[model samples]
Target: MIYFFKLIRWKNLLLIILAQLLIKYALLEPLKVDYGLDTALTPLGFILLVIATISIAAAGYIINDIEDVEADTINKPDSVIIGKQISEKSATNLFIILNIIGVVSGFLISRAVDKSAFFVLFIITSGLLYLYSTYLKRITLIGNIVIAGLVSLSILLVGIFDLIPVISDSNKSSQLFFLSLIKDYAIFAFMINLLRELVKDIEDTDGDYKMNIQSMPILLGRSRATKLVFILSLIPLMIIVFYLSNNLYKQPMAIGYVLILIVAPMIYSTIKLFNATHKKDYKHISTVLKLIMLTGVLSLLLFQFILLK
Candidate 1:
């Protein structure tokens, strides 16, 4: 059981579940009192939606590990599980099984919501995750963007299911409000994950290079890769600053919290990325980026504060 969870990067899986729950409960539920959760889908419907999300994510991890088996032997030999504890055949089977479940559940739920077209979303996500492992993982730049966009989709999925069903001609205000917030978080996730993906490329440069994967690090060199990540970090940093400057300024405490907890750490990440050379250095950079991502999600708690007033 422990090996299974660890294999799927279970902590990260749980974090996804928690993040979705927080959005559904902490954000959407409160808004419901003012508007509506806006879904004709029952509790069972939302449960299936969460299932679809987790199933696709789990399948992604399985395939990612399958592709990483060779690279992991070189980069982190101790972590490789494909042919050791779990056979390649077994992992592939699980990948197929989970994807089927995710897609089927999505198909049913899409039909429930009068959007039969949504089944394509599940299929596309599954295919993209597979392609990301098989082909894109070897390509430069494009691979990182694909994975980051999928990460954003995890957050956006909730909004899509919850809001899309009820978007009539009448309540444009509610529909637009939810869509805007979802887009904001999607962009935020994209920036943070894109940075993390590049940092991982730098960290895993040794294995990736041996695999002849044309990652930014292997193509551009370590210092240049770090510089690229540093440069890209500015997009999100500026976004948060503008976010703070415009939205949170009225609440000094909120502004201070955003600046200190979120903004400062990103600035610090950029500075640290410059001097990082060893794998361990890039490992720290990866961890710092993960922290920033978590803080960005947790910042949603502040919305409660604003709503209370």
Candidate 2:
């Protein structure tokens, strides 16, 4: 049971759920807006959306593991499960089941919102994850972009599910406000995941090289790839700094938090990245990126105090 959960990366799934919950309660629910949702249906609606996101994400993990078995044998041998602890056949079964559950949940939610047409988002999301694992991931940098796009979609999924259906003459302003907020979150997700995915490519360059996976690291060489990742990692930091300079410079605590916890560490990571040549070095750098991602997401909380003032 533990292995199964680990295999599907339940931790990350939980993070996705938490992100959605924070968006709802911390950000949206408090706003003086209709939100296009009945207060009565809010909890159950959120739960269904959370379940659907987890199912699709879990299915993605299963197929990625199945497709990357050989690559994992090189990069993460001890953790590969498709043909060792669980058979490939069983993994495929789990994939189908997860997709079914995800799509069904979306279907039900669509009906509840009177937006049955939006169910296609679920179907398209599942199919794309499958395609990513099976083919797109083997192509090269394009795979990273695809997965990053999907991560952004997860943030937007909540808006599509809960806020869109209620848009009308009266609630249009409220709906637009939520949509803008969701868009900000989605862009944050994209930037963080794009950075992480590039780091992962560098981390797995060895396995990817042997498997002819055509990853950025394999095509660009580790030295260049690390440089590229370091360059890319600075993007969000610079953006945030500028954004805060204009937006949060008036707020001492929020600006301090970004400078110390977010910006400073990222600068250190870039320096560490340049000296990192060994696989273990790349591994640590990858972990640093993961922490940065968490810090980025948690920055949403700063909005609370910012909004209060």
Candidate 3:
């Protein structure tokens, strides 16, 4: 059971669940958004949506591990599980089972919301995850962008399933407004995930190189790749600062929270990236980036206070 959790990357899976829950309860509900008030999915339906999402994500992790066993053996022998703990055959079975559940559940949710077309999102996500594990991940920047896009999609799925299906002519304007807000956060997730992916590529250059994977670090060399990642990190920091100044300046508590928790840590991570030479340094930077992502997600809780004032 422990090995199974590790294989599926349970920490990441939990983050996915938390992000969805926050979007549903913290952001949408408190705002009194009317889009899904009448025809929206029930609580049970929402749980199914979360399950479908994490199932696909878990399958992705499993397939990724299966494909990267050789690389993992070289990169972090201590963390390798495919061959040591769980047989490769069992891992593959789990992957297949998860993908089935994810797609089927997504189909059910789309029907529940009376937007069957939304089912394609799950299909595309599953396909991309499979391709990412097999081929795209070895290609320069494509893998990073694909994975980041999927992360953004997970965030946006809340808006689509909750708001779009219930949108009427009367509520269209307000519905879109909240959706645009969600999109902003999704873009933030994409940028942060992209930077983190690059950092991981640089950190895992040894294993990737041995596997003949043409990642950014292997192609451009670690020094140049690290510099590129550092430069890219500034994009999110600048965006967040601008958002705080323009949108949250009137709220001192929100501004302070954004600065101390999100912006400040991002700045620190960027600086750390500039000086990161050793794998451990890059690993530390990655951990910092993950924390920034968490803090950014948690910032949704601040919206209730903002809306009240």
Candidate 4:
């Protein structure tokens, strides 16, 4: 059971759940936003959505682990679970079960919301995850971008499911406004995840090279890949700074939160990446980036107060 949880990356799944809840309850509900006003999901419905999302994500993790067994044995032998603690057959079964549950729940939710077409999002996401594990992940840069897009999609899914169906002519502008804000956050998630994925690629270069995987670090030398990741890391920093200056300049509390929790840590991560040489160093930077992502998600809470003011 413990190995199963580790294999599924329960921490990441929990983060997904938290980010979705914050967007739904803390950010949208507090604004009395028109986007979800008409077709607002009840608490039960929202729970179902979260369950479906996490299940799909879990299945993705399982399949990724199954496919990466050789890579994992080299990268982190002690942590490998697919062949050590669980058989490949059992892991594959879990993957199929989770995908079934996710798709079925998504279908039911689409019907409940009267937007049956929305079910395709889940189907597409599932297929992409499979392809990513089996093939896309070996293509230089493409795999990182694909995975990051999926991460961003998870954030944007809240807006799509909650806002799109409720939108009418009367609330179209307001709906788009709120959705645009969600899109910004989703973009943020994408950029941050992209950098982190590259960092992980660098960290696991030895294993990836041994397996003939063509990750960024393998295609471009380690030094070049590290330079690229460091440069890319600056993007989110500039974006947040611009956002703070333009919108949150007068909101001391909000600015302080962004600076301390978001901006400062990002700066630190960027600096650390500049000198990162060992696997442990890249691993630490990855952990820092994950924390930054969590802080970015939690920053949605400040909007409750900001909006009320």
TM-score of each: 0.95, 0.93, 0.98, 0.97
For residues 38-135, what per-residue lDDT tens digits would candidate 4 score against the true structure?
54577877887998899999999999999999998999999999878999999999999999999999998888788899999999999999999999
Ranking of candidates on lDDT, top first:
3, 4, 1, 2
User: How would you encode candidate 3's per-residue C-alpha lDDT over 157-186 as one tens digit per residue?
Assistant: 999998899888877787887889899999
Which digits, one per residue and each the tens of the lDDT, describe model 1 over residues 1-309?
666777778767776777677777777777766664464457688888888988998999999999888888999998888898888898899888899899999998899888888779889999999999999989999999999999899888878887777787766677778668777878888898899899999888889988889999888888887887788788889988998788777897688777888899999988888778899988888888888778878877776667557
What lDDT is obtained when candidate 1 is compared to the true structure?
A: 0.83
Rank by TM-score, descending? 3, 4, 1, 2
Superior candidate under lDDT, 2 versus 4: 4
- After superposing all C-alphas onto the true structure, candidate 1 shows an RMSD in angstroms of 1.5
Tens-place lDDT per residue, model 2, 163-279, is: 777677777776777678788778878887888888888889889888778998888899999898888887887887787798778899888888888788788777888787888
Ranking 1 against 3 by lDDT, winner: 3
TM for candidate 1 is 0.95
Model 3: CA > 4 A from native: 33-39
lDDT of each: 0.83, 0.81, 0.92, 0.91
Q: Model 4 — which ten-residue stretch has the worst lDDT?
A: 32-41
How accurate locally is residue 6 in candidate 2, as Cα lDDT from 0 to 100?
A: 81
For candidate 3, report its TM-score: 0.98
